[model samples]
Target: MIGQVVLNSNIMSVNLGLGVVLVVQDGVAKVSGLIGVRSGELVKFKKCGVDGIVIGLLKDSVSVTILGSDREVQQGELVERLYEVVKVPVGYELLGRVVDGIGNQADNKELPIELMEKALVEVKAPGVITRQPVREPLATGILALDSIVPVGRGQRQLIIGDRQTGKTVVALDTIINQRTNQRPVICVYVAIGQKRSTVSQIAARLKQEGAAPYTIIVAATASESAALQYLAPYTATAIAE
Candidate 1:
């Protein structure tokens, strides 16, 4: 007999299977009545049709970071638990495809079910002793960088400089060079807080260079929320793993 109930402007109750939004502030909402939920679990706002993630479990309510426009969330809105943590599609099929910050396919095509697998977006890094050693070299196709500052597989290289300094070009070059490598190397390019046009140009360039077949672009554009931009790198890492 459980159903939706509205107590007041600040509180609303729904069926036992659902939760009520208590307060929303700065893209985080406080919701109550959800049972057996864990942090990082995904939830949906029924009315707004947007998703959120449980970030903190309070005494009687849970803190949710909205994945979409927080302005759409209202007090007393019903929330449904997805019963799963945030996950991204990972596999060879993702190569040459563009995905959003949360792993949604953005290339306007249906993802092939058989070629994809879901992976948790958040995972702890393995201990140093258990990690693989970086012994093989990864050429960036940049003569100066490869000759003076060689990069190894599984190594991290940072290209930092002022705007319009070709930082993106360097990264794109590295991705393009992977195509020439003897061993197959999958490159994941995560664009956080960049403009949509910029991401599009990068994708087009990669395609023109014949590197699109081996590279995946995960873009969280500047117009997206901070939460999404923050999650972009983790989502990319999960897909790569």
Candidate 2:
């Protein structure tokens, strides 16, 4: 289904490039007639205000990953390049809250505090000269993990396993362990393609264990669009940094 395109008066003042949806395929839409759009730029479908991000530059069109309900978009619908990059909300106020990939509250409560600080979702890493060596240990408090595989403050560890495996358990334990650690590290748990109930349970567990004060949950449930799931990790990382 396609919604009627509505052009508000502010659109002209914003100098947004206008385009038309040429094709819609599996969470992606091909848009034509847009100019000056780079990969990762945010765009909005004029029809229903559904957000999308430019993922690829085609010969004559741009491939945009639709971030919201894709069912509201259709071929020939109007699109407007927002002329802005995707950003996520950042601040201490985000602690203990469940947010979506875009940093909007997912717990169904009205966020009374205004989130004034925002950061771009994508950033370039610092050069070697600006980097610092990892000297501190990030203890997970799990005897099995601490003895078998110790993780440091700046190390990257990948926990992989089949379905029903204890991958999430390992991550949750590490997060919960931070509650009593000497140097507490803020934790941001990103849930991608997970059931809503599973995300809720994790949040509840964190709160019950007294770790929610220093943790944030970014959830893109299984029911959400693929675009959101793709953005979840980056969003969580931005919040963590």
Candidate 3:
């Protein structure tokens, strides 16, 4: 009934309930049915099977690759997905262990279900789904701090030293390092001190590393409510997760 358009080649297709959509364009009519639909995308309104080929998905349309050449399609034809009205990631568990903001488990429990279909997938800690060996070095720039600190992939390492020991710098470096890895980790910097220069430096560094897309920053200083500061990291983590 409703799904995101994922592809449109000889056949138009979408991520249906648990499968892909297949719409035959040329076989029935040919008004440039498959003018859009490439990889890494979503489509809505239409539905079909995972393996079946369809004809068109003007919505969220990207030029589908054919035998040899590629072409452009009307982006307007594709529709962006509206957020769902589903309840929170409850009927779930999130305790003890540090978990992302979403209801997804951060501890060692296995998921009970599988997402066999593709719809409007949300940012669930972004890369928590992709596992890469935690071997690539993530530099901290500060010699003393760098030497003493270590963070594993998907780790929940907290910075608990005294004031002015460069905790922010440590966070900044990890954000920058993500640019060099094949599967980079996402960083959500939550600054409680309300330092302007520090946040500015972070923005500049993110541009340098080309990792801005994967990083999120939250700043709340002395005057703001303690409640806000306490909740900042969790909020950012939830969005990223």
Steric clash pairs (candidate 1): none
Off by over 4 Å in 2: 1-16, 112-114
Each candidate structure's TM-score, on Cα atoms with residue i matched to residue i, is: 0.90, 0.87, 0.38
Per residue, candidate 3 scores C-alpha lDDT tens digits across 22-113 of 23232121122333333423333222111112223455332222111111222223322222311113211222122222223323446432
RMSD to truth, every model: 3.4, 4.1, 17.6
Best by TM-score: 1
The number of residue pairs in model 2 that clash at the backbone is 0
Native-vs-model 3 lDDT?
0.41
After aligning candidate 2 to the native by TM-score, how far in Å is the CA of 88 from where it should be?
0.7
**Candidate 2: minimum summed lDDT over ten consecutive residues — where?**
1-10
lDDT of 2 by residue, 1-241 (tens): 2222212312432365788787788989987767667998999999888999999997667899999887899887788878799998888888889999888889966664464688988888668777778787788989978888889887789999998898999899999999897657899899999899999999999999999989989999999998888888988988887
Q: Could you say which candidate leads in lDDT?
A: 1
Against the unseen true structure, what C-alpha lDDT does each candidate score?
0.86, 0.84, 0.41
lDDT of 2: 0.84
